[model samples]
Target chain A: MTRFASAQSIAHDIRSGKRSAASTMQAVLNTITQHDSAIHSVTHLFAQQAMQQAHAVDAMVARKEPLPPLAGVPFGVKDLFDIQGHVTTAGSIVLRNTPPAAQDAALVARLRTAGAIPVATLNMDEFAYGFATDNAHYGITRNPHDTQRMAGGSSGGSAAAVAAGFLPFTLGTDTNGSIRVPASLCGVWGLKPTLGRLPRAGAYPFSASLDVVGHFTGTLEDLRNIFYIMADTPAEPEPQDLRVACLGGWFAQNLSPALAAAISRVCAHLGLTGTTELPQTPTARAASFVITASEGGTLHLPRLRAAAEDYDPATRDRLLAGAMLPASTYVQAQRFRRWFREQVHAAFEQVDVLIAPSVMCEAPLLDNPTIMVGGKPASARANLGLYTQPLSLPGLPVLCLPLSNTGTLPLGLQLVAAPGREAALFSLARKLEQAGLAGRYPHNTQQAA
Target chain B: MTSPPFSDEVLVAARAQAMELALPPACVAGVIANTRVLQNYAALIRDFPLPDTCEPAGDYTP
Candidate 1:
């Protein structure tokens, strides 16, 4: 009944009769009651349903039936997914008129099939469009490490919920850096699995090409467990000796001294041999924006044209601008995607995994909007996902591993591998976590407001 | 950066071609202003001599 015991740990405890499923549920409910008023990470709770699910898991265990990996573990889902009996708002007021879903998303169903409980639907950016979960519609999802600073988004609430110890794990969607950025900001581990590795049916559509469902966890063991249950791959053993490539040039350039120092420390610890000099990422980032805006713009053109005022102003103009993009340009963006993936794939010849800073800087304050990283003024929304967007282009599996300490704001280091090689990435992450290179929300960030 | 020869009216015409929406005259300026970012990306692509035969990933229909 530990509030922050991982899903795997909770399941083990439940199976071993150390804690009843009801007791665990009570602990979670108590934690939410005690902490959520100021945190507000959860938007809506399915308390009764969660208890029902947990009890069913207990009954199964009592019958001596083999339990699923996530049996009796409570989970928080991002607001964007369609959970049966709840409205899938995706954090926008425009969707207020939509009716409750009749069924769960394919991913949600898969998790439930594995015996995980959906305790609540967490907050997110409107339409999954922003970097910070500072939605004009949902207010803002604050960082658990520092309430004043932003939790990277549009999966901010999911990351913050796990970091705040309300839930040991949560489900979120990453388009661009939604999962990784928040994982970095909140000092939690998160994974954006290979595209189509998990089915997307019933999740609200963003950009078809880039949208990926991901999960957040406090430790690499939880991250790997959740990923194994979620991804379309066989789990592997904990990492021993695997070659890691430190991405240089575009991925490493212009990072803040603190973040650069942190990445340098991680590399030094790993004894990483650098490889693969990527071309300038600014062009790749700009190209990614074009792809997202144009696709997102087209997808919402009807709503945009009729109820433009209903959209978040931050995303509104971008969608409208996307409506104006040339067909040839969209085609060009796709061509660039192919070329970029090929370029990245060619690098795998020399190394097993690639690593980079998840973001160029630490979480910025939500109230004070503009961000300055490495002496350059950056758009708080667009620039926060700088290290993440290009990888999203090729639909690679990337893990956001948090490296910051107790008193400091969180920063992340990203590990990526070949599309179906989630086991490799998880293996490496587990090793780093064991070495104390990555972990949960730091101790100082654990204070309740 | 010099503004592209393409004017706001032309870009709006292209947007209008893709969708049906009556825009206020003032709105055309905003779309074009925001689209300047795309032009910067275009400039970046222009720097690379992409092979004419290059194809995009996931471009083919399943």
Candidate 2:
């Protein structure tokens, strides 16, 4: 078996008596013990809990009890998510002292119910704020492909852990591309479910409107299985012909040459037409920022006002600015969100899926002086979210599939489906993966470069 | 319905009103520069023509 086969394949083996859940759990724990020193993907691992859960699953198999959907699979949840009895740090010291959660977050609880054990709480950007997973409190989560490069943020640790083979798949949240960007940089497949399709009752809130619970898996089958289990609602109607539209304008034309080439390769592989003109995305990204700031500021106003010093300096300033936004501006930004979502739907009417670069470039070297794109100096913060923020506004289910060779410190093309249409997205992705079009893991960039 | 841009003095006052913890002078300067990003976004939204039927985001009720 491939060491990092998708969870669904592993589950099939476990259920068919070819592998025991206990053996899979032991293998995962051994892998983490052997490999996590350099990657630092998981912050707090529950070795005892995972083994205990695995033992129970094995006993169920022996007794001929109905197996759970994800029986014997291991996964990681971002630290921002509540996993019951652990501190939900959200990758900062401020919440480190907070009381343990009485129950798992909805997403975590769902994973458990599916028979997947969350082996650890992975690291993330502070409060899921930044695009680079350079947490001040927790050391940065290094890209598994190249130790020196970054794993895209907020969900970086989740992506890196999967890339490094610590787990087959992991759970993450996306508010403005946290899930997709990191998945792209880390060379794995991840999905951002449509907003509200997965209940957000327990995950740490970034922006109520934009924040979405998503997951990272290496294979298309795993993505489909996990998505079906995670989404609170039933599957929606599937689309036929499954035509994908290439989104150009800001994301495609303005992307770095390397990223543009990667997207081109993905389009060629899928036999999709590349278009030059698409909806204005830069403006949509701008609108998303305004809304995120206003809502984020409001969410953290009390804490920010009380102990601003406790927050990471980078996120602290952003929240403080959010607190200072005029009410009218906040209202206007929300109004813009509605219009933007409608415009996104308009684009969907023309195609079943819209494909674009997950980020403007490949993973940049850690601590680079400045991030430059296409020879143009850009906001290190703003540019990371440029390709992702527009889709986040509408809470569209986005699947990020890596395109470059494993050693290239991979880039990805994003497939965004219409709202609440995750099944359709998965169907298309499965088609691509079956045709050897989607990217997969074991992408060891370290050996090549 | 563009809101009047807040001056530096107003920003400083707002900072005070918001009870920002004592930040380093350099950090304060950085905040000012970053806030400009926010203000530009504020202007973009303010300039857009929003539908009259647009509703506030919150818990829905009958």
Candidate 3:
């Protein structure tokens, strides 16, 4: 079925005329329409426009014109991304009256140029503020692996769309674990490329310094290929004989037994005997959180003044709190970020990549949304980024690869590298996939039944 | 490191007045709760041993 087909395979088939792009697009649309109710990943389907683009690809093929690498592949974007002539909601109603974007977000335009059709705008947390994609206006995006559980956000819909096989891949933005948290929980491959590596022209902003544009894909190959296309760079060869280390201390603590075993498996496979601790991890995480709140709050302060009532209560409250943060506090967080980045960069001197858990455990149940932190059940929304937020402070590239066959729900591991070192992350992810240690977690049909 | 004692009500009142925000009465309590969370996180950052020469990361120009 086209629903779960990799973007690379879809492009090959379309170019080979094994299937028309129109049929592929229609199949994805039909599948989304039929099955999306259970998961609520999609907020708006670009049916007519997507079909037209698919037809254009077919026409090009008919003329013997060269097809782009991702020709005829359907993908979705987090609702925050501007998709030309459509209003970017950024998962909030506060901007509902704002004019439609005049152009596609930079990455969306790049992907379109590479022949990938944007099929839908996916769900996300209001203003991309929450880790859980439980939107006050749009409703929650349920985990496909277990519908009763969460699909992590504000990129939750992007990850869920890929995890549920609705699209080959989807665009998302990460500022403090939006991409990694959801990708980990939903059991798909996601990448938060090095900060500023990919342009962010029209993606709605949150935490300017920390915001990174990236994507989620069903397959590692798709993730790698689309990443180059979006980054507008040729694939760099991954270095062989790369040094890797596991992150210990704060990262090693408060993990579920299943997650602990999964990390151990990865470590044993790589013959990693010792762990490298990032200096002041708890402070790193706290600094990241402070920066996010301050920046996001400041960005929305003007609107918050005018129409705070129009915002989601959860998001509005956080933004309000962020707006109230003293300037000294925001400044100090940025100072800490600079220091933390240097410390993290120094750690790379000893290792090419650092391995850490994407989340402490699997997706928390929606009915009882809590994750264990320090031997107590903590609010899932507040603590889900326990691991990811610290890493964000350094602006390093992190590939969130889903752990495979853990005999439990999906767990994800972060393969992290220094800035502009995504190749190493990709290389390590490929190795893990080959070793049967990392890959997409298949949707649980038994659980659904 | 201990943070200086701060009043949530005072901070919220000043923010509301400065931003000209019309926060609903219902939202104020939630905002205050979240403000406390921010305060705690801010304390952590404030306590980090950063030297004065360490500038905030600005536009990166290679």
In Å, candidate 3's interface RMSD is 1.6
Docking class of 1: acceptable
- The TM-score, computed over Cα atoms with residue i paired to residue i, of candidate 3 is 0.97
lDDT of 1 by residue, A409-436 (tens): 7888899988767878877877777777
| Model 3 chain A lowest lDDT segment of ten | A440-449
All candidates in order of TM-score, best leading? 3, 1, 2
- lDDT per residue as tens, model 2, A90-118: 88898877899989998889889889988
In angstroms, give how far residue B32 of model 3 lies from its true place: 0.9
Q: Highest DockQ: which candidate? A: 3
Between prediction 1 and prediction 2, which has the larger TM-score?
1
Tell me the tens digit of each residue's lDDT in model 3 across A122-196.
999998999999999999999998999999888999999999988989999999999999999999999999999
Q: Per-prediction TM-score, please? A: 0.93, 0.91, 0.97
Better of 1 and 3 by lDDT: 3
